[model samples]
Target: MSLEDLVRGAAAEARRLAAAFPAAGRKDDLPWAVIAAFDADVRGHVERDRRIEDERDRVLIASVTLAETPAEAEAEEWDRARRHLVRAVDYLEETVLRFGIVNRLAAKRGHGAAGDPVSALRRG
Candidate 1:
């Protein structure tokens, strides 16, 4: 799948996981499963983009840590997970925007695909 689609899917899953927290309760395993799948998708994307890997890795790590850490109360844990999910969604949305901008710029420059913008410019 395209990076945009992968990111969108992950974002949707994150939102679903966030929504599940309140109804599933702390002991439920469903949210954890969703989180694991989401993390894998994010990690795979990060791995594919070495240029931004460090920054994205940090964000992913921080979000996962925050989301996974147990709180004294169930409510607090759910709240934290929801907040992290919101940030994840925001990050994914920004990524989608960046992809759109890059694709537009590539098309304008007469490139057939959004691959190595610098190289395309050098060729031109």
Candidate 2:
């Protein structure tokens, strides 16, 4: 199919999905509060994860700087860098999954191995 046709199809699908949103409820219903609570819970989990990752980076940095030998420090630095790349790629794939686009061009994108970071990392 032509690129224009694909774009139009995706736009139509998005509109169809948007139309499926639930209608507003009666005044007696507490759905708004429930939705807010769900939002807060998700935000809290995300924030906690960030804190944990930050701590790990901080500890790794301190250890690498304190290593007695240059070779040891270099090894520690490489290990920490590898860990960071793994986490970043994992988050990238998760974000792509949440993205609404069908991503038909993923494998065609200019990432060399595969456009998907997680898959490319695994292949290497």
Candidate 3:
């Protein structure tokens, strides 16, 4: 399965099990312990996903900082600022989509795409 589907399924299962095993109730299932068959792999995915998000944030901050420098420039400077913004947006869009943040945020804002989150499973 694709990473998105895998993450989604894991999220669903975690939700389902949350009531039965509340976060506060677990003892032996410490932060270092594996809770399920796919626990380790899922943890790795989460770590990588978080790293990507962190990188995205850094890129955005850098872009904004660069953008500020051109804000007071003349016509040519405005063009430079526009270019900077475009590059920042492009990089962020790709990173956000790779992390499925766009779809997840869209769903939260009632703008979810019709595309299946598990389209790969359906294809096979």
The numbered model that scores best in lDDT is 1
- Write one digit per residue (lDDT tens) for candidate 1, span 5-106: 455676677666656654554534544554465456434333244434443444455456544656556776667666765675556545433533224343
lDDT of 2 by residue, 54-117 (tens): 4334433432332212343565554554344334323422432232132224224422222222
- The residue pairs found clashing in candidate 1 are none
User: Each prediction's TM-score against the native?
Assistant: 0.45, 0.26, 0.34
- Cα error, candidate 2, residue 40 (Å): 37
The models' CA-based lDDT, in order, is 0.49, 0.31, 0.39
Q: What is the lDDT, from 0 to 100, of the residue 105 in candidate 1?
A: 40
* Model 3 regions more than 4 Å off: 1-51, 70-72, 101-124
- Estimate candidate 3's alpha-carbon lDDT, on a 0 to 1 scale: 0.39
Order of candidate numbers by lDDT, starting with the best: 1, 3, 2
TM-score-superior candidate, 1 or 2: 1
Weakest ten-residue segment in model 1 by summed lDDT: 114-123
Worst 10 residues of 2 by lDDT: 38-47
The candidate that wins on TM-score is 1
Model 3 lDDT at residue 99: 48
Query: What TM-score would candidate 1 get against the native?
Result: 0.45
Runs off by more than 4 Å, candidate 2: 1-72, 103-124
> Runs in model 1 with CA error above 4 Å?
22-47, 50-77, 96-124
